[model samples]
Target chain A: MEAFHRIWKKWRHLLIYGFILGLLIISLRLLRWKYVIADQSLEIYIGIVALFFMGLGVWVAMQWFSPQSKTAEETESIPGQEPFSIDEKALERLQLTEREQEVLGLIVKGYSNLEIAQALHLSVSTIKTHVSNLYSKLEVKRRGQAIGKARKLRIVE
Target chain B: MEAFHRIWKKWRHLLIYGFILGLLIISLRLLRWKYVIADQSLEIYIGIVALFFMGLGVWVAMQWFSPQSKTAEETESIPGQEPFSIDEKALERLQLTEREQEVLGLIVKGYSNLEIAQALHLSVSTIKTHVSNLYSKLEVKRRGQAIGKARKLRIVE
Candidate 1:
């Protein structure tokens, strides 16, 4: 039972994907039989199969390219807390100052430093300093790289 | 020539998508012929028909989904630039202190306050302060809402 639980937890995503793919294949086969085996049913069957496969292909592609989950609902609920041990190490690598990290968040949104400073009510120089610090800690030289790193780390989005 | 350029630019993504979907349908038809079709010549004919319809389906879907030019690459290049523009007032709704923004990023990654402090090399109190500020700026009482607001503003992810 314990082993089953662990496998279920780890492979749920794969199981869901497999289930969807199985349904698609079965649907395709049904359409094939309905059309190829019957004369009057041919055109409608072909149309249905084409539509189903095309829709399935596009849906699969969308899932493939969907944004990584960063919703608060996904983040805040601790599933036994131990799941975060690996993430802790990634955070350690950032080495940001508290304020700098805050600025980095805004910077990732493609905010100009001036806009950030105004939003934060900090001196523009202070905002710039935090941004430079963020760049260093993220090991990225550009705002885009920092944002990419943050996303990869799941620190944002 | 100018008209051709205009049309090409407008329909480039649709054309690429159509080409890809066409290729997929062709491959699927080929697979079907190899496995299911008893007559080789008939199978080849069916494959060609499948490929044609697949191409047509993709063209139609492209016309459906390609009205917005917000490609994935473009979205990644500039983080907050969504295809649809929101109201200007909605844009101005939430503003975080630079430091609060950074903490929010780490928090979204399921970081504890102590972990966030250590990562940012700040005292726990300072981290808490930033967190509180983030909550206030986002007008949410919980960490999850802060993350949600950050996402909505495209501030973090």
Candidate 2:
């Protein structure tokens, strides 16, 4: 063990450097391959990649803001202000089952998954699955966004 | 000229190979430099970049589908069915001026920069600037995406 420790101490830095060098070489190879497959010219590859990302980012931005505007139109979002219109269309689009809807309501009411399970006389795992399904339907990750989008879509109220 | 051509033909492939090798070496060195500058260790960097792209692709897919779901609710997509809701909000957020809007319309209709300039009775450089500005606002690079996104956002319609 002492000898092993000694070897490790002596070669630790070299090991790290070697690993880093290997990674750089591999990454450079990938870059070079991409550069070649993209017409074997640096300028062309760069121009392509740059434009590709620009188009992609713009599309993403448009996707993000279009929905926001559709939902927020004529409904100025003051702090704690409720959305005036309940988007029944959006709710129908989400396709949440009745059980998932129950779990979502309790979730927005600040109940834990276990608490929701007990309240609904379901297993904790079942509640978790329901919550997850609801989140998937709403395209949200957290309780807050789930609740917010649910309200916005009129899935909750 | 004959002698020069004779020697050039003899050494042409060698010269090309040498140039390509030099570019690869330079590219590799630059890659090494970037990894160092980013304060990234190799494994962590590779892992992160891989996962980031995977996550980004999944999110993009979700976004692409979510809007489809919202728009296609109860009305399945038929062939050549026009998007019912024109996303005017996306255009409003882009902050395009009147002239730029006109230039964009021409661009969508397959007018070249020169054509747009002549049609608008403006200089080609002015048209170029307007096109560039429209691209900047739309966050796109290619004319196809610019036009497609414009139509999607209902900026043209």
Worst 10 residues of 2 chain B by lDDT: B68-77
Superposition error at A133 for model 1 (Å)? 22
**Candidate 1 C-alpha lDDT tens digits along B24-109:** 65665655545645565533444455445545554454344321123322233433333544343543565555677677767655
lDDT of 2 by residue, A104-136 (tens): 777655577777889989899998888876765
Model 2 regions more than 4 Å off: A1-87, B1-157
The residue ranges of model 1 lying beyond 4 angstroms of the native Cα positions read: A1-14, A30-40, A67-157, B15-157
Model 1, A84: alpha-carbon shift in Å?
27
TM-score (all chains, Cα) for each model: 0.33, 0.31
Docking class of 1: incorrect
